[model samples]
Target: MGSSVDAVVAPRGVVDLRGEAGAEFVAAYPADAVVVVSGLPGAGKSTLLRRWSGAARVRTVDPRTVHEACEAVMPAALPYAVYRPWARLEHFRLLRSSVRRGGPLLVHDCGSRAWMRRWLAREAARRGRELHLVLLDVGAATALDGQRARGRHAKARVFARHRRGLERLLAAFTRHVRSGGPLPTPEASSVLLLDAVSRSRARSVEFGAENATR
Candidate 1:
């Protein structure tokens, strides 16, 4: 069973990655930071990383691409349950490898998994690196629409769980920010909140000299 976690609080800083300014901000984001891009299954985490993967010193691990490849060859009627365990195993194996060989890493996250976030935080801390979050705040309807557009969808029960977990996380962050309380996770140095529009506008994820000092 998953370990129980306390409510997540706001981070040290929150930035909206929208417009030219947002793009520029991403370009100047710290090179050494470990950024986790999190959202519901179709909230464009993969899309954003695909655009920015070519940047120097930035490496990304997206499990969806691998899963998609496997799906192409597998029978359409085969239940995902059969291969999901293997896919998860491969994803974490790659994630661990990336963390071990890290310079700058971007991870795709399904917002429902608190254990994954905790593991990432511990890994970053162990390596003396900072972990950050880039959370997508898209509505459930928008996310479901995206799933259809991508021709991939999570089971209804799974999607419902994701929606609830993400909503709670967002709400907790909001409350902490409003109250000016301690951050939710000290392991995470900062969090960036982006909507669909803002995510689209961010063209490149760059790391500059200025960020290295932070």
Candidate 2:
């Protein structure tokens, strides 16, 4: 195991990256911390991870990647819904295994499941790491356009449900940022809130500053 950790590190609440102009945001964390990237469907989570300019010193866990791999082997006429459960199960298994490895991680989530985050927090804490969050705040129209661009679409009701989950998470972070109270996230150390501009302008998410050069 790595060195022991006492508590969540500095930058303990929300770091809102929305209003800053001109500078690209570079997120820094401990060498093996867990960073979760969350937003609504089509919020560019996958694209952002793919666009990392620096050498990747972290492992990324993307559900879309899992789904696509499964889709490729699936029968053409079978809708994704038919095998959705299996894909989700695979994703969970992969994420769990990845988390257990105890290296830096970048995860993609929709902010829809409190239990998932809670479990992640527990696991990270057990491993002497902290869970960080990166949230992309975007409008419904923009998300839909993203889906169309990628040839994937979330049903209206499903999108609405995701939106609600995001709203709740955002609200919790908002309160955390404003009041400096207990974090809604179990054992989560920090969160970075980003709007479309900031999200587009972000340069990279680095595990540790040393990785940027390596």
Candidate 3:
């Protein structure tokens, strides 16, 4: 009976060994690493990752999918909205195994609050992996201009979401820079901040500049 138990548990021990030594063994198994790209709408997060494709980029449609999933589970508007944030948490967990294996960045396009970004940083630190942020510091005026120039299909639900999201991004930016937090810097890892106003015709002209290098 003791021999049988040992045989049954030996495989689990090997699995634990693989999991604990993930940093080294990840190379053999091909794990996925996600680099969250966040900014206000028209900040070019999508364009950046799309232009420079190497690893697999996974997307999280928290705003839309999470809402739908919530309705399915709860069948009430209040609970759906209230528990939406928790539902999005699943994305982080899904990336854990992939992160250990280390593959392509899971590009997160949604505009997350600054505090949320800090939380994500903590998660990255605990996992022994690096967290990089690409902050496209386009001013509100510029963002508004970009939005106005957008095609009919590109218009989002309302101006409120952008306004609120912008406020959050700016506040987060201030906290990120001055708070002495783990926010990525050029020397630490890589935090690239591009000024959109410095370039014109942002869609093709200015955006093209970065693409040219790629």
Candidate 4:
């Protein structure tokens, strides 16, 4: 861990890491900062979150875990889509509860839901904590490879939706930065963009008072 993002610090803005290589990122911020790890369906958002959560010793509101718990008690023949609504509700509830308690929370988001992003950013602001984005910008082909690698294939339509959402999001962020307009979303003070290479290169994400969680 040799580099810092300075994401929510002075002159707060986007901290792009797409081109960085050979540097293990140590994303440091306030102990209370809320970070949203976002990307397409196969962009490895959950994987990165799992790694960072262990390293940062931070609690995360991940819907996948909720799905797993729900799956454990349900009939084996039933598809996850049948109970997705309940899972979503449970995830939302957990996220709200976690945010209320507050202090260096990491959220796994697919970047496909604008409303969720807005809500997260607002909730963080309400708690006097900054909301930052750590987006994995790996493109479509690579993302699809990731899905196959994980053996979790997102439906085609859903994957397309996520891709489009991510494209629009990145475009909006670019325009905002170029025009010096408002942030991409509510209460989002900074965004850190990373690609597959950079994400892998990042060893850990540390939150306040730096401890070697590895």
If scored against the real structure, what TM-score would every candidate get? 0.81, 0.85, 0.46, 0.87
Ranking by TM-score: 4, 2, 1, 3
- Candidate 1 local Cα displacement, residue 96, angstroms: 0.6
Model 2 scores a C-alpha lDDT of: 0.77
Q: Is candidate 1 or candidate 2 better by lDDT?
A: 2
lDDT over C-alpha atoms for residue 35 of model 3: 51
**Candidate 3 global lDDT:** 0.42
TM-score comparison, 2 vs 3, better candidate: 2
Best by lDDT: 4
Instruction: List where candidate 2 sits over 4 angstroms from the true fold.
Output: 1-11, 210-214
Q: Write one digit per residue (lDDT tens) for candidate 2, span 1-214.
A: 1223112122446677666555454566777888888888998887887765234646889898899999999999999999999999999999989988987888989977888898888888887888988888876788888999999898899999999988887887778777778777755787778778878766666565533210
Stretches of candidate 4 exceeding 4 Å from the true structure: 1-11, 177-179, 209-214
- Tell me which of candidates 1 and 4 scores higher on lDDT: 4
Q: Tens-digit lDDT track for model 4 on 1-214?
A: 3334322222147766676676465666668988889999889898888888988789988888899999999999999889989988988899999999977899888976888888888888887988888889999999999999999998999999889989998888778766868767645777878898888866666667443322
Task: Name every residue pair that clashes in candidate 3.
Answer: 31-101, 31-102, 31-103, 32-98, 32-103, 33-103, 34-106
- Model 3, position 112: C-alpha lDDT score: 45
After TM-score superposition, the amount by which residue 214's alpha carbon in candidate 2 deviates from its true location, in angstroms, is 23
lDDT of 1 at 184: 59
Q: Write the per-residue lDDT of candidate 1 for residues 37-140, one digit (tens) a residue.
A: 88998898888887767644478888876677668877999987788887788788888878878588888888567788889888877877778888888888
On residues 157-206, what C-alpha lDDT tens digit does candidate 3 reach at each position? 54456557756654644666556454333212334344553121122111
Angstrom error of the Cα, residue 171, model 3: value is 8.1
